[model samples]
Target: MARIVVIGSGMGAMASAARLAVAGHRVAVYERAATYGGALGRFERDGFVFDTGPGLLHLPAVYRDLFVKTGKEPLERCVALTPVDPASRHLFDDGTDVSLPNASRAQVVSALDAALGVGAGERWGDFLNRARDAWDRTRRPLLEEPLRPDWQVLGRDPYPSVRRRRVLRRDQWAATVGEIGAWELADPRLAALLESYALAYGLDPRSAPAAAAVLPYMEQTFGSWYVRGGMRELARALYERCLARKVEFAFGAEVVAVTEKDGRAAGVELSDGTVVEADSVVFGADPRALAGMTSGRQAWAPGDVEPGPVPPGRFTVFLALRGGRPDGTVHRTVVHSPDAGAEASAAFRGEHSGRPTITVLRPDDPVTRPDDAHEAVTLTATVAAHGPVDWTDEALVARYADGMAAAALPAVPDLRERLLWREVRTPADTAAATGAAGGAVPPPALAGAEGRHLHTANTTRLPGLLLAGGWAHPGGGLAHAGMSGALVAGLVVEGDGFRGSQ
Candidate 1:
């Protein structure tokens, strides 16, 4: 059995460690922070708890596969997931509102027809059908495949023509969504919805590949979900599984470098000068951070690495309120400006406009939140990282906080007065804490026709070195990260090289 050292105890790291350990490998996970979950963790302040990252849960099958593969069932450990109807509530500046329900296509079309107009329903139906096709075509070849050289897949020449042909086919299929906004949908609202889906990947729909259209299908079909407790419970469940599998975890141990000898990974050196040697190393952190660790390595060069365009960063305001919950009881809300395109353009141009794309999540789900006396609400707004707000200046930070509050909680005029607690996080803080460059860690931009490739790492780049995080191919999000981990495990097992250690 090979000794494996995994850097960063994020969901990706933990999931991979669990799988490797279950396969009988001696797996050790090293995390920089004190906690096990990186972004999937929670912080409590003044009787209020906040998930530091990732609020919604989508694609339950990803986690299910991880648990089942590691010899545990997720449902047995975590609370049962309930479907969220009206998956999200969209509020527009012109007093217009749209609710996307978790329902049949006909139902969704009817709802759109009622909200947007007569022809809109038909247009939405067509759009969703196209998205479904994209999902089916790309899920296996692009997402599930390990993007690496494998002796099993490559029996003779590692760079075989057949493998190249498969890669090309996957790339061609992934590029289809680039026309969604410009050609696919004529209605501005429909186009906006399509664009919004792309924004989840921190990509602009106009430039995003067709593979992205798959998101709507997955969301509408599988349905968005929320854990019985907060999303952090999912991380806790994984942590529990890792323990059961006897995976060794070293929290608060930051890795400084990946040591190499004879052009192969030897192990890692920690920030405190501790050297831990292993047969293989799995880096489950941001690819940029991992690249930084190889400062003078010849196998990889810094200039060869090309990070994706940093998506617009976010400004968040957390409020602890003492008021009766809204009657409708919406779990997620997306408040859009009437001129969303203009607002997005302004933000992209590094302008701080009063209007922002706002999203709010209330901690009122009966399963997650007990009928307590207090309630919590999280308000988020997308802001340009290069905006006028001075991140280092404390006064500017407070001013920006007030600006976000005014824009987001205007309907609830007494929002500030009812607050039992308040906190703010800027892009700078998110970048530093999460290890994502510019606080917006998105995948490399979809490759162009000329194939202008980005040097960002893929899910699998080398033998025994697998990536299982937001940085991996098939890219970001809680569910995708977990799937990346499991996919890598499957690759290793299929190679017949994985053997568990006692």
Candidate 2:
């Protein structure tokens, strides 16, 4: 059996390790932090618990498949997976509020029409239909399959554009999400709804390709889910599954360098001055970290190019409220910013917009609070990465957090009165914990933009080294990272010639 060494205990690393272990390989994982689940973190204080990472999971099938393939028990039997109905409630700037039905296009259309206007629902439905086409065209090549040698085909946008007559001008093809919203949706509220999807992932819809419309489509189609305890629980279950498969883990073991022998990866050197040799290596850390370790070696496979600047990280505020969650409250709510263009510019281009879009998550799960009298409210916003904005400045961080909290007041009435202690997590904290440069949170790989958005391939130029995390192909997001693990395992176990995950 090959002695496989995996770097970092992120979701993708653990997933790959578990699958490889099940495949009869001896897998060992080295994590820089003392815990697993890179970004899926939980913050607890005085019996109140808040998920610091993604509050909800979109496209849970990724994890379900992982559990089914790696163990005897299915995911549901292992973890309490519950569907979040009325998936999300949106509060637009114009006081237009709407709750979208989970995974039901007809219901969503009806609700939008009722809330926004007569034609609003129809326009949204049409946009979704176009997004569905994009999903169908690129889902396989961009997601399910491995990065091909001639990936330029993916550079060509697969989002089908509708032809419209223009006076004294050529018909413009929609390329960016913003263009799609402006050209097709027309309504400011509808445009905001579409752009919110991109912003939530730290993507700049203004520059993000029209394929980004698939973001909302995937969520609306697959539905959103939540774990009972917290998102952290999902990480716990995966870690447990890896242990069950006999994968060994060395926590607090920082991988300092990727050692090589005869021009191939030999193993990894830890910060503690110990070396663990392996037949193959799978990295689940940031690509920048990997580059530093290998002295900038292009572990990229043929036709793979270096990724552009990493996207921004998330800035979060965890609130321990004094009152219990009221009955019949949606799990997620988005408070649209007064100015979306300015918000996007600030986040993506560091334009410094004062009013940023904020997402508030209030889960009624018992595990989050100390008792029935308390509730945990998490407020998050996509911010510029650490360096340019200086997330390390305590005063600046506190001010930003306060601004976000104020923005969420519309959702949580009496927020200041129900006040309990509050905690702020900055991008600096993410960098310190996950080792992501500038605490940049990479967005999931998407098609279009001349393939500039796609991540580096899982298989590297080095014979025995591979990538298996958000930083790799298929890119970030809970589902995408899981798929990265699956793809890495397929290539390692089945052979480099393996096309994709089946």
Candidate with best lDDT: 2
Which segments of model 2 are wrong by more than 4 Å?
Answer: 301-303
Q: What is the C-alpha RMSD of each candidate to the true structure, in Å?
A: 6.7, 1.2
lDDT of 1 by residue, 1-502 (tens): 8898988888877888898899898889998777787777665666667676777777888787778778746554655567777788776666666888884677888888888889888877876776666566546534565443321221111110111124346521234343554455566677667666666555554455555666777777888887766788888888888988989988888899887766567889998999989877888866656555765532223333344555666677777777656767677777665566666675566666566666778756543322465667777766766334446567876887777677666344567777776888877777667666666645422323222222233333334455667676446778777766776566555553422211
Best TM-score among the predictions, by candidate number? 2
TM-score of 1: 0.85
Each prediction's total of clashing residue pairs, residues at least 3 apart in sequence or on different chains, is: 8, 1
TM match of model 2 to true structure: 0.98
Clashing residue pairs in candidate 1 are 23-500, 24-500, 24-501, 25-500, 175-210, 176-210, 177-209, 177-210
Q: What does candidate 2's lDDT look like per residue over 45-121, in tens digits?
A: 99989887888999999999999999999999988999999899999888999999999999999999999989999
